[model samples]
Target: MQTRETFAGLSDWQVGLWYALVAVSVAIFVWGALRLVLKYRRGRGAFPTDNLFRRVARTAWIVLTHTWIRRRDGVAGLAHALIFYGFVVLFIGTAILAFQDDFAEPVLGWDFWRGPFYLGYSLFLDVFGAGLIVGLLIMATKRARNPARLDYGRVDGVGSRYERWRYTVGDWAFVGSLLFLGVTGFLLEALRIAETDPSFERWAPFGWIAGQGLQAIGVDGETAASAHFGGWWVHGVAALAFVAAIPFTKAVHMLAAPASVATRNDAARNRLVGLPPNPVPEEIGYGVVADLTPAHLLQLDACTKCGKCHVACPAAASGYPLSPRDLVLDLREQAEGTFGVRASLGVEPLFGSDANLLGNPIRPETVWSCMSCMACVEICPVGIEHVPI
Candidate 1:
């Protein structure tokens, strides 16, 4: 029988410190997330409220099946689905461990990490961890091999210098953090097995292999223990940091994407909602980020910058100035206050005589290039309405 330990060899104070760090991280995440929510509320648009249960069911199905993604790119969709399911399982496993260590054993005088349950849990995590790794590698390789393939020719001349830099940096940071989290998780597992010499180590196939490799390299008991401790702290800190950064990074898509999918207007897929007959024409279309409705602004945050929209965009394929992906990124940068002078206050106007999106970030030619074909809208995994926007 395998036994689990709570906080392992850490002192009470050290454990308390960990909890404190988690609390602080959670608070920061909440504050940032709330700011985003409040900002969205400042915009003017209404989402559908009918068919609540149906919407929830549909959203769940879409996420589970990767339906929209698979519609066009089957292999990439499969890779993403693997990563998503693996992450979900690993998250549930983490919750279970937390419950067992913090509440179950201490309050209920019971533990679940033993015998059949322990073996099953260990095996599941090991298998899923490998899956997550493979998925990440596939995505990373695709991005590296065809970095420019997603560019809609707009990013080259559009947006402020700061905006461009921020997008580039944020993209790398998001990918690097996820990769770090996945890799370090497996390393910590391998180190733990090596240090403890667990009888059930073989059940954790990947960890067992890693442990054997480390052993073959002459990693002794004391060295393994030290490395395990270091890896544990590194993994824990990285996880907490990732959580804290979610509201400010591309990871916000994880929450916003599902909501976007659930709230999408199925009736308006092919048809652009006609403006009220003979409406006053102050701004014929979106001139800036500020011109977008609340729902549209929220959709910007939901975008994963996956470039599926770009790939599907007719204008982009024709070598036009309009890349739906670039258009979204430009608006997203302004929404997040990454451009222009008022960026520090997070209230920067996206368009002006000098900073107009129509002729500046997005050229007049780009605005006219949109055929309103809805290809981008139909293929967007997050349900972003590029045609409508």
Candidate 2:
């Protein structure tokens, strides 16, 4: 019988406004996702649909277990796994709350999100939330150390300073934003617990401890209540915005990378297809970005800017200005800028001629510098068909 109320203090108008914002956020997310699907469609061929169930199972196992990521850097992999699991727990926790609020209690009169269940859920999320922050700290520390593999130093140096700074900022921002969201979530919970001063909330161990600290620091019930109201909206809005931004940011990897794994073909990666028996000039291999297979196009988006491929490439090791990582990123920049959210936002592309890839950003030296050893493809955690691309 120890249940927390949803939307307890907010007026009807504020609740309505929140739902409206939620609607807007969902619409934007859907729009961006559709744009990505359409962008993939623009490529030459379809991703194979055979053995879908098996592929999906394989993908889920690989992705959820982080086996591929762990192969190279065990510490980074463990941190990433923490982040992934924490995010999943929190996400599922939110869904459970929403279900009870919207359907279980009101519609079905099955008010079960209380007592043991609520307490357990609270404790679970509190632990995972802390884990999320810990994971981010680990990653940020790794970034600070400036490891050779995580180096964002540009080999091409097209926009040189701007691109380097932007990559650096982008990586930091991704980590920072998730960290911010995680911290704010805990703070919001603490404020609520402080406002109530309820014994039941002790089940939420972290929130209870933080709330006691706040009370000790002269945050009375009234002050905590007022602060909670504002913090609720802040966290809610930011969370919604984060959801909407997923398809447009590095977060898109959450979707694209898994899909890349699911659709990956060993046959496609290993074998180089030869020309047709009576091949015309147009019937040969790729001449433009448009000629890439849909899977390859999708793979471009799956690149997390993780520099393992760059480190693995012999060309890079031999002092060539060709980073497989950078090459994928440059193409992704072109893809994003030419279509989808970046294009819609009027962001200019960073690579290749608008007509076709090769020169403007990705130099001929960059292309020829590739040793065709498939080291990048082998080293890539995500199923990016680098050699084929």
Candidate 3:
């Protein structure tokens, strides 16, 4: 094994890059958080209520423990649970690095990853990364094979090719990214260990097989060290790309969810009354017609597209005209179309009303299809308020 050299500290460029990443991530996360805060504050008038607390508690339990999911989905539910929880634990690994590289190593003589902490940290990184990779692989297989012996109609009222495509392909990319992170990270760690301690081959359970195979090829220790560094670069770049992609894709929910939960209001569970009619007064409007308010559009962005919301609507399950999943996607689709237009265009039609300026192709039946069961609200990890106001 090659002699190992550990950097006591980062170079100026490394520190600069680390700070830049932190600054960007924090800025975006804060922007998303503030948006939710302003939304709830204005919408709910800053009043607190017991009803709100109870509803939040219930939703939190369902999302955090995934209890509703298990009761409803069984094996598929467990797969999702593993992925969700595994990512959380994996995030802790990054947090430790952030502190160590950005703050601790500069101020203190040592950082967190020195002795006991390093041991425990390494163990957690191995377990959580492996768990995430395995769980993702299982989900990928299930997406392709759907071995639960149930069809789409049995679970929800109906499923379409577009729906299936929406689900499986994007899911594969996300899962594939996670698996790649795990494999590259493990190999990188193994190489570093081999450089420092030949016996490290015994402790690293996940990558020892691959390491031994390379060793058997009589690859010189210097070459193996180079490979390890390359793996480190691969893992780091992949992780960064994954982070950036979160804000633009379904992964956005990872950040949006906590904000939503933290900022939910008292009336979130109750069915949203359609636009109020004031005969003698100033204004009359129906529910989300042409232009989705920022709150409504936020709800769409927060959606995981996991189809959990579809199970909440009785109409969707009973073969009526509503699927909460489809409703949200439609909202997003139309909103994307209307992005640059001024909000003054009046409400768009959510249903069939040509006379109304706000009406769109989103049908009245679909709008009315909700049972107001709050299933979407309950299952949503991000705390999206699905009940129309």
For lDDT, candidate 1 versus 2, the one ahead is 2
Weakest 10 consecutive residues of candidate 3 by summed lDDT? 349-358
User: What is the C-alpha local distance difference test score of each model?
Assistant: 0.77, 0.84, 0.58
lDDT digits (tens) for residues 1-389 of candidate 2? 78788897899999999999999999999999999998788777788899989998999999999998987899989999999999999999999988998899889999889889988998999999989999999999999998887767777656553356677777888898899899899898888888878898998888889989998898858999999989899999999999998898788898899999888876645675556699778656666666777888899988888898888889888888888888888777777766656777777753332457767447888888887888888777898878777
Q: Which candidate is the best by TM-score?
A: 2
TM-score of candidate 2 to 2 decimals: 0.94
TM-score of 3: 0.72
In model 1, the clashing pairs are: none
What does candidate 1 score on TM? 0.90
How well is each residue in 1-389 modelled by candidate 3, as lDDT tens digits?
A: 32123432346687577567756766654554554444333221233344666766765776788664576568767887778887888898778776786578787856555555555565666777777778788777776775322122323233352244544556667778887887787777666655544553444466555566666676437876777656665677678777766754567677655545545654666655454554433233334333334455566666666566666567776878777666666655454334312112344422331223223435666666667778777665455666652
Task: List the candidates' TM-scores in order.
Answer: 0.90, 0.94, 0.72
Question: How do the residues 347-366 of candidate 1 rate in per-residue lDDT, one tens digit apiece?
Answer: 64443422455654556777
lDDT of 2: 0.84
Ranking by lDDT: 2, 1, 3
